[model samples]
Structure formats: structure tokens, C-alpha cells
Target: MKKIILYLMSAMLMVSLAACTPTQPKMETTPPDPQVMASTGGASDKVPDPNAEPMEIISVYSKNDNKTGLNQAMDAVDKLTAEAMVSKLIEYGVLEEGTKVLKYESADGIGTLDLSAVPQSGSGDDKLTIAAIGNTFIENFELDKLKLLVNGKNYSSGSIKQGDNDYLEYVKNYKEIK
Candidate 1:
């Protein structure tokens, strides 16, 4: 009887341990590659899966071009949701390297995007940067409004604000940067 109780206790402990935050990024690729592992630094919940069927990433905004301010382009992602496509944005140099999407959910036309360690935009183009990130989630998640959060709390930087009245709207006029 004692052995049976000990075994049950051990099983329950193992189950409880599995519910904790993972040590590695939740890349569904079974076998992780070195580049993505180092890039996201386990900050992402969903990473691209090479073995999985890639989905079309609607628009990955980039400011790499000197002439065009913010340009939109398409790419392939492992998953078909905005959460999965966020890693692609990091790869494209849109969101900073350390930026992490902690939680994402939408309902009643409002999408809450919780991030971690978001870099503050000090330049005069904070609106453009906000549009790039907001539109990505808005267009992809099909939300009429966005609530950006940092570390599960409200976020604000430069011209951006995270409050009930500070929701962001979608802007679809970004020219492609080629």
C-alpha cells in the first residue's frame, strides 16, 4: 500500500511539473535548429516548424528600404495564425530580437497582444512603427482593435499607449519596400 501511494504521488508531481513555463521556445519542429534557438532566445511561445507545412504570412512589414518608409510583403510561416507569424517578423527585423509575444487572443473585435521586453521607439516615426506591428496583428487576426501589452501589463512608448481608450486601428496603405 505504501508503494502504491508513493507511485501515485510521483505521477502527480510529474504532471504538475509539465505545466510550468518551458525552458525553450515552443518551436513545434521536434528537433530544434541552432539559428532560431539563439535568435528568439526562448522568448517566443511558437517558433517556425520546418517540417510542418508552411502557411502564407500575409504581410511582413520592413523598413530596410531607404526610400519607402514602411513596406509590406509576404512570407511563409509554419502556423496559420498571427501568433505563429510573429517569429517571422523578428526574422525580418521589424520587431526587435528580444521582443516576445506572451499571449494573443481576440474577441468582440478586440485583440489583446501581450509582449515582453519591447524596445521603445525614440524616433519621430513611432506611428509608423506602431502601424507596422498593429496592422500585422489586426490584418492577420482580423481584429478591428488592438490592445498592446508588455509583460502581461499595459504598454506605452513614444506615441503609443495601452489603455481602454488607446486601442489601435488597422492601416492598409503601407507601400511595399523592394
Candidate 2:
């Protein structure tokens, strides 16, 4: 009886030990939805980055210390067209105060933005300024990309410049959805 009790005790101890061991989590091999992935723009959708700019059609996203260009604490406006949105961004100091959109057009998820002025000093400012504008249009229009033109030519400011074939990509994150 003593031996049987001791064996049962050992068995219980082993069972408890086995139960305490960690197991690998089960993973599903389900394929991703093509439409969801495509619509989200896998690269830009990796993170959500809303900035402080007042968003109507779209808000500007400025580069922060982390280069994230996002702030959770921002407000959203409505009813502004794309051109008016850019004007508001200028008011917020994302672009040169006197900058003007020479032309703005978008169709089929592609936007062509022709501007009169862009930030020329401070590489950081230039990058964020361009990023703010491009990101604004991209998010609002659900665009694949924005082709930036300055004074009928490709955009160039500080250390930033776009080639004839180049298009603007998201600044690594997106604005908050209101």
C-alpha cells in the first residue's frame, strides 16, 4: 500500500510538471485577402501615423524625432477640397507660407501636384514638408502615389528631389481615420 501510494504521488507530480510546460502557440496558415492588402497599401499600413495638422480632406504629416510623423491628438475638419486642404497646411507651416498649388489633379488613385514654392532650407523641414503634402493627398484620395511637380518641373527642395519618373511614397505611416 505504501509503495502504491508513493507511485501514485510520483505520477501526479510528473503530470503536474508536464502540465506546467509551455507549448508553442498554434498558428493558422490562412492566406491574406488580396483586396484588403491592396487597399491598405501593405507598406504604409504597417503603422498608423496621424499628425497634428487640422485634417479636412487630409492632414499634413510632419517628421518627428522618430520620423513617424504622427500624433494621436489631432482634430478633423470636413468639406475642404484638396486645394483648400493644401492651403491650410501652408497655414500650419508644413510648407513655405507663400507656397501655392499651381495645379492639382487626381484620378485612378494617382495625384499630380504642381506647386509654386516648397521649403528650401533645413533638410528635415523639406522632407517633412514634402511628406506632409504627399501623405495628405495619398490618405485622402486613397492614392497609390503622388507625382509632385514644382513650377512645371519635378519637385526639388533641400536634400529632397523627385525624378521625372519618381512618385511620392507615404512617410512610413498614415493619418488617423475620423
Candidate 3:
């Protein structure tokens, strides 16, 4: 009787221990819906749309920095803006005989740019260059507004200092794009 009782208790304990053990999460083996799968095509089907509108790059000008003076910031801005402009021009195939950007007024969180010094290349690279230049201007200037002009004419949208809407849209539509 003692032996039988001991055996029963051991079996009960074993059963309780087995019950307490956690079950593994189930793996998904079945393929997704055929219609959804067809729409996606394959893993490498994602590509950037050329027809999509490019994101706008906002210009950021500096107001005041205690650590770095406005002069230092302005100097940095000059260098960066020049480089960006050059790069954009080159990318847009608009390299001309005498293309230069002169600083008209840059102070108190405002940058007045003069492009009259730049010769007309007519390379159709202006748009590409402007995008690059605008993006660069925004990144380095830290200013509130950057006014762009071509040959002393206000050709572009007045300010490149706003936030990037395209980037935000991209982030939001990532799932759809993917």
C-alpha cells in the first residue's frame, strides 16, 4: 500500500511539472494570399519612382549661438553653400564659363544670395543643382530663412528654411512603397 501511494504521488508531481512547462510559439509555414503576393511580385521589386516629386530641402539660418559666434557660423555657411552650389551645378550639367554666387546680405537669421555673378550655362542642371544647393543651404546655415535669387531675380520659392515634407511623406508611406 505504501509503495502504491508513493508511485501515485510521483506520477501526480510529474504531470504537474509537465503542465507548468511553457509551449513554444507556432511558426507560420503557409504562404500569404496569392493576390497580395502577386502585387508584390518578388523580394527585390522595390524601386525609387523617378516620376515622384522630389523632397524639398529647407534652409536653416543661424540666429545666435553663444558657443559659436554669428560670424563663425556665417563663414561656415559661405563655405558650405558654395560647395553645395558647385556640386549641384556640376550634377545638373550646367557648368558655365563664369558661374559664381555672391553674398549680398547674410545677417540676423537671413541670407540674401545673389546669383547674378553666375553665367548662364543653360545646361538644364539648375533644378538638380538647386535641390542639392537648397538642401545644403538648409543643413549648414541653421538660419530661419534663406532667400535664393538667380541673376538678381527671385526665381525660386522665397524660403528654403521649412521642414522637409517629402521625407516625412516617405516615412509615412514606407509600407506602401515597400
Candidate 4:
């Protein structure tokens, strides 16, 4: 009877030990390639599957050469909409390449476009630049109004304000391609 009780306790302990042992997470069983491991400082990086399909990107339209055309694909969509907008303006050949969009937000049907690192422009360039921005936003995002800022300060445009901020208006000289 003593031997039998010892055997039963041994069986229960074995079962409990098995239950306590942790299971390993599922991972690729293949050993890391020597060349790949060496290139990544002895660590394997997540490599994109060669068979995967390319990601689809949305292309925004812009005015170029006095006619509208397909511009570059959008770099951002939601919160960074102003960055994409400024990029489209650059694509339109109006805004300079180094212009930086600091912030972009929309509230109560009003959109704010804050910019920095923008190049100084003459009156002619400013007109063309504003028109390019206005037409693109109006045509693509259905936004006819916007508050533009340069380096956190309001743009000095006395004639362009609608209510409290400078609003984007349509420019008759900019012709859109059919």
C-alpha cells in the first residue's frame, strides 16, 4: 500500500510538471542565412516577400503648364493632407522645392495650412503659388477655403481674407486640362 501511494503521487507530480512547462511561440524554423545575418549585424531583419503585390497609391492632380494633369502619388492622406497639398503645388512648378509644411488641420469646415522653410517670392510668384494651392485643394479635396501661414504667422494678404483668415480663391488665369 505504501509503494502504491508513492507511485500515484509520482504520476500526479509528473503531470503537474508537464503542465507547468511553457510552450514556445511559433516561428520560422529555418536557420538564418550567413550572408543575410552578417549584413544585418548578426540579426535577421524582416524581409518583404518578393511575391507580394505592390502597394497602390493615390495620385493627386495639379495644374502644370497652364493645364491640369496627374501629379505625383500622395505621400500622406489624412492628418498630413497639407504636406501632400504642398507637394502637389511643388509639382505644379509654383512653390519651391524646400518649402516645409509644419501643420495641417481642419475644423468646422475651415482648413489651416502652416508652412516653414518657404522661399521668398515676388508678387507674381505669390499669385501663381496661391492659385496653384487653391485650385488643387478645391478640385481634389473639395476645399474652397484655407488659412495659410508662413512660419507660424498669418500670411500678409489684405485682399484675400474671407472672414478672419486668408481664404483660397479661384484664379481665372489657371486653365485646367480636359
Candidate 5:
């Protein structure tokens, strides 16, 4: 009789201990939809719609020291048609204060940007300023690449060309100046 009670008590203890073990919650593995990605400000490679009506939206980035600032969103403008958007970028502090866009036009999906003025001093500032303008045009418009001209001269004398990925690569690789 003692052996039977002992076995029963041992089994009860084992059962209780087994019940006390914790379980891991099941995890979800599905990707979110594109609308969810956009609303959350997640980066997406989806190109802008060319046929949609034009409006203005600010796409901002900081070159160094992650700091957030004020932003107001509206419909994105048609970059090809909106010359004022470049001026507005300077006004809104998206571009540097003195940056100027003399002309912005596209032919056969290749964009040509004429800048009346650009950052002259500080290698970091020059890189970021150029990248900001080029990236803004590339991201906003349906362009294969951009030809940047300053004061009616080719930026870097045929060194910056489309289809070779040099310009895009440079803009992307630009490290921020302190």
C-alpha cells in the first residue's frame, strides 16, 4: 500500500511540474501590403505613377546625425512640370538655402538639370547637396538617370554619365560631413 501511494504522489508531482513549463507564442512570418508599407514611411522601390494628377509632397532625408524634423504631406507633384518645386525645396529647407535650379527637363526618360548655383566649399556639403538634388529628381520623376549641369557646363566633363551607374553610385555612396 505504501508503494502504491508513493507512485501516485510521484506521478502527481511530475504532472504538476510538466504543467508549469512555459510555452513560446507562435510568430507571424508574412510581409505587409504596399499600402501599409507607404503609410508607415517604409522605403519602397515602386516608381511613381506618371499619369496621376500633379501635387506637392516633401520627401526629406538627413545626411548625418539622425535627427527628425517637421513635415507636412500632400499629393506628390509631377516633377517634370513643377519647376517651382525645386525653389520650394530650398524654401522648406529640403535643399540647402542657396541652391538653385535654373532648369529641369527630360527627354526620352533622361533628365537634364541645370543648376544656377551649387555648394562650392566643403566636400561633404557638395556631395550631399548634389545628391539631394539628383535624388529628388530621380525619386520623383520617371527618369533612367540625370545629367547635372552647373552654370551651363557639364558636371565633371563627361565623367558623370547615364547608364553606367557612376552618378547614381556616387550619390548613394556620399558619406555625410560632420
Candidate 6:
């Protein structure tokens, strides 16, 4: 009788221990916001102004060329071209409503465009702005190279190193603008 009771008690204890062990919790993942995901519907989001001003390209004939003369000429041309391009884009509704051209200049065969524009209300992406600015200048400029500078320095990669920020640097060849 003692042996049987002991056996029963051991079995009961084992059963209780097994029941007390915790099970893996189910992972709960909520789906992304529907409104955010549904914002971009189709190809219209990627279209830019076809007649926007071309990208400005400065040319340095030689490594020993006069930097001041080259910069002055490039700056004059860049200012005009940038203004025209931004105006055209805005007129065609390709740019956002409040978008505007803040300034532009070229130095030693490098043109930098500064814009005070933001994506449209529903666009939610600045890719179109980037494409438009790069492509338009490349198409309109004589040289095949340029750089984009926001504020007072280069925004991305190119030949010019305006400052010391990694993500802010955007470099591209003129042929690669399209």
C-alpha cells in the first residue's frame, strides 16, 4: 500500500510540474497602416516635367585653368538655368504647390542647385524632385557633369566635397542623371 501511494504521488507531482511549464507565446504583428501604404497608387507619382530647365554643367579646360573666371561664368549661367527650370516645373504642376528655387551657382565646372521645395501633399516622396532637377540640368547643360548643393554645400556625391557628412553627399556623372 505504501509503495502504491508513493508511486501515485510521484505521478501526480510529475503531472503538476509538466502543467506548470510555460508554452511559447504567440507573436502578434499588426499590419502596416493602410493609409500610408495606399498613398502611392501608380506611375503618375514618378512623372516629372518634360520641359523643365536643363542641368547646368561647368567645364574646366585644364587642371591649371583660372578658377575665378570659370566659377563666375558658371555661376551666371547656373542662376539663369536653375530659375527657368524651377519655373517650368512649377508651371506644369510637376513640382509641389509651395516649391520654389532658392538659389543656384556653378564653380569650376560644377553647378549646385539649391531649392526650397517639398513633396506634394500626397506624394510623400522626394524622388521625383531629385530626378527632375538632375535630369533637367543634364539635358540643358553643355558639359556632362554637375553636382547638387543644398544650402551652402554639396548635398550628395560628385567631384566637389562641400562638407563632411556621409548621407548628405550625392555624387553622379552627367550621363547618369537620366
Judging by TM-score against the true structure, name the best candidate: 1
Please state the error at residue 29 of candidate 6 in Å.
Answer: 79
- Lowest summed lDDT across 10 adjacent residues in model 5 is found at 66-75
CA RMSD (A), model 4: 13.6
Using lDDT, give the best candidate's number.
Answer: 1
TM, every model: 0.60, 0.57, 0.32, 0.48, 0.47, 0.36
Comparing candidate 1 with candidate 3, which one achieves the higher TM-score?
1
Which 10-residue window of candidate 4 scores lowest in summed lDDT?
Answer: 67-76
Clash total of candidate 1: 0
Better-scoring candidate (TM-score), 1 or 2: 1
Question: Higher lDDT: candidate 2 or 5?
Answer: 2
Clashing pairs in 1: none
What is candidate 5's TM-score against the reference? 0.47
Candidate 4 per-residue C-alpha lDDT over 1-178 given as tens digits, one digit per residue, 9 for 90 to 100:
9999999999999999999999998998999977655555433566777987655243444435543533333543443356766775666565778788898777666677777844445434445456656665554555557776777887654333334545775454564323
> How does candidate 6 score on lDDT?
0.48
lDDT of each: 0.72, 0.71, 0.45, 0.60, 0.58, 0.48
In candidate 6, what residue range of length 10 has the lowest lDDT sum? Answer: 62-71
Model 6 alpha-carbon drift over 4 Å, by segment: 1-80, 120-125, 151-178
Model 2 steric clash total: 1
Question: Candidate 5, residues 1-178: lDDT per residue as tens digits?
Answer: 9999999999999999999989788786888876656454444555788997866564533344432222333335545343655665565455656667777778887788777765454444455555656666665675677777777666652222323333432244434322
Model 4: pairs clashing at backbone N, Cα or C within 3 Å: 68-177
- At residue 60, candidate 2 shows an lDDT of 53
